[model samples]
Target: MTFAVAMYNLYDKPISNVKVVKTIPDDFSDPVIRETTEGRGEVEDNKIVWTIDKLIPEETVLMKFTCSIMVTDITKRRTGPIEVTYKANSSFAGGLAIDKYDAYTRNKFYVDTVERDEEPGVWDCKLVFENPSEFILQLFNADVYSPEDESEKFVDIDPKDVSLLPAGAQWHSNKWRYESEELPAFRKKLEFRVMPDFQTNVNGTISISDVILEIASITGGMSYDLTQVPTYKEQDVIAKLKIINNGSAPLNEIAINQQYFTSEFNPPNASEVTMIWDGDEVDLPSNSVKFDSNVFRISLKNLRNSDTGLFMPESILEFEYPIHCVNPVKEATFESEITYLANTFPLSQELEFRPEVPIIEALHLRRKFRIGKEVIPIGALGKYQIILTLENIGTAPLQNVVLMDKVPDNFEYGSYSGGKPQITDEVGEDTLKWTIDLLNADDKVEISYEISGTGEYSPSDAQLGL
Candidate 1:
């Protein structure tokens, strides 16, 4: 059978340095090179290689070769598919691109014979011929033969009559009935052959869709204490971006641009912002500059596909810098945009940034002591009253607030007021624990306890564990 391999340039621009490689099946032998359209190709060790300098847009390169199928046993005979890989360099699309194609002889034309039913002495068989190729197949002749029985003759199709089979079309033969004393087991001896017009060009269309790119950003460490307004004061702030190619085609000539505005509240230098690509430090693009010496523009490039000839689903780029803001600010914003060339078309995605402020505040714990109506004396030994206050001065509510207060060594355990406190007395010290389910903003809880001084007590001897 003669096989025609074709490579079509689906891109609009001309492709240079074209290389086509084809691998033949093991069952086929003695490949005879018939012709090539643009370049010479030869079969080397069961593989064919063709090199063309350039291929114009919409141009197709065709290579023809002939190989015969060796059938030792009809039931055990099988052939593998022909695999082809092509690569070309496009100037407009930035560097090399690759594509693969597989062609199977079985996919082109095949026949199947199955036994429908079998009675005591009769057998019914059905034969079907299928054309699965994209182009029309001109079937010259087809025949079924049974060599075991002399009564069963060979069914021959007229060679002069040509049958045109459309793409994805099937042809069924008339059911054949065989009568015998025993059931017909037509498994090993049944054989079929099909002769089709093989020198014609099999045409098909190739569609190259536009590339689709999605970009997302996540800001880290954007929280602040509610006691003061959110400020960026020599603190590290990170912006993580996830760029992905969600299209069928590869994207190239990629560039990412981010503009960071620095005012009196945020005075981050352009050099201070370090750009990391896939965990490696990379130099910024030429277009990156510090506009007006305050507004910085960060540009990155060469974000293309990997060696596997496909773009990665996600490419992470992180920008980290130290923010120096002396005064508090309501908010800070930045803008980022990604531009790339996909299928020879320019595409871009822009993202608006609004830094997030986490709802977290600093917890305050105050401890004070008094004796009767006045503050505790320096060396008083009477009963002393200890006051503990836990306040939540943040913008958000605090959950699961546990306050642990340790009593002094010389103080004796006493009853507490205002809140129920779990007291655990150890050998040397005692612990007073208070649990609050929720503490809203500006809310405070005070717990007071009276303890008698058993030994010589001083102000420095009293230590509050919070």
Candidate 2:
């Protein structure tokens, strides 16, 4: 496939030092470069780089590349993330900030005075200028005269010779010493200028938008007969996947690939599948939405040159369909995963998601009880060992569970494992109950207790309430 990547000078001013670095996808073959508009196109470091001297306003530069594909069952090809950089004549993408005239004059000027111990009563001094702004300073001239006598000149910097001061920098004058009993003072007059803002007559700019590709993720759960599945023997189960575009990049070339494990599930027809994004129903492209015995695919945008996508950035999309239970005779643990391919067209980049699919499963629960009764003297005394085990064998944890077991009277409760369960003695039977507050799916708990009475103890089956 051959696609055109172009850069347009949108501003009214000219731009210079243009550099474009277009990264070719790994899946595509080495690009076959075609003729460019004006700049030179070279392949360097596995990148197609195009650089131009300048671009006039409204001028566009285009480059074309032809890449072949392997044409497998389903393939994804990307063309971006392209990097374009250029400097406009007199502008910045982050907005311009030109300081006021007074701010440029923010500087400091002072004279250093040091007393000489070697020569008593003599003092040395130097004149300095400190620039605190970001512009270069031009020092014109400075004159220092003795305050005691107006005609006595101490320091003189010529006005004809201009001195340059670096930005946020300082300048110092030659040192001079004065012989006087008291601290000597001088009068000074200075002249300098601050560099002014720039002004030019340039016209035109060519700053191409750099491609920012972020892989869109589908984050939502499957909704079906989760808690109310047991209400009907056979019914149509609905599966839904929700997606929200949380990033700034719009979603395009969207397609869904879903897998079903068993043949007992009857996938809905292509026409029956419903897709909605931003409250508008989306129509699947013809001959692209396919349903197989165990898998199905819904293509929102056609695989070739999709003009529009499923949803824009900050939008929501929902894909829902019905799955008929072909056989509801046996216990079913329905599990399936749905993942989506979100891509940006033209300057194509994509993110593949492999997160676990939402599953509706019947968590494993085993409730069992064991009894050991001992009889003494053929019938006089009896002893019993009751053990109840509860195991949660699922990925998620199990909540509350109440275990109830009834034992006949005359059997005194002995030691119990973990802790003794609640005991309530009735007339002819004693209800031995254990309330398990929580049980992690990866753990198991066992309750063992011994009882001795007059006759062989028969314990009823342990029951669970969830």
For all predicted structures, in order, the TM-scores are 0.32, 0.33
Flag regions of model 2 displaced more than 4 Å.
1-253, 259-295, 299-310, 316-418, 422-428, 435-466
- Tens-digit lDDT string for candidate 2 (1-466): 5657788888787788788887766666767778799788887756788888888999988887776655442223344567777776555433645666653467788889888978888888899888887777788877788886768777777755546776878878889987888877789877778766554434333344444334343444445645223222455678777776655556566677778656555667877788776787867555767877667887766434453434566777787888765544345666776777776654353555554555554333333332233222222345556667777766455566766666555456667676777766532357777787887766777777666664554433222111
Residue 453 lDDT (model 1):
72
Number of backbone collisions per candidate, in order? 0, 5
For model 1, give the RMSD to the true fold: 22.0
lDDT of 1 by residue, 381-425 (tens): 566677777777665566777676766766675666877787765
Q: Global lDDT of each model?
A: 0.51, 0.65
Runs with alpha carbons beyond 4 Å of true place in candidate 1:
1-236, 265-295, 302-318, 322-326, 329-386, 390-411, 414-440, 453-466
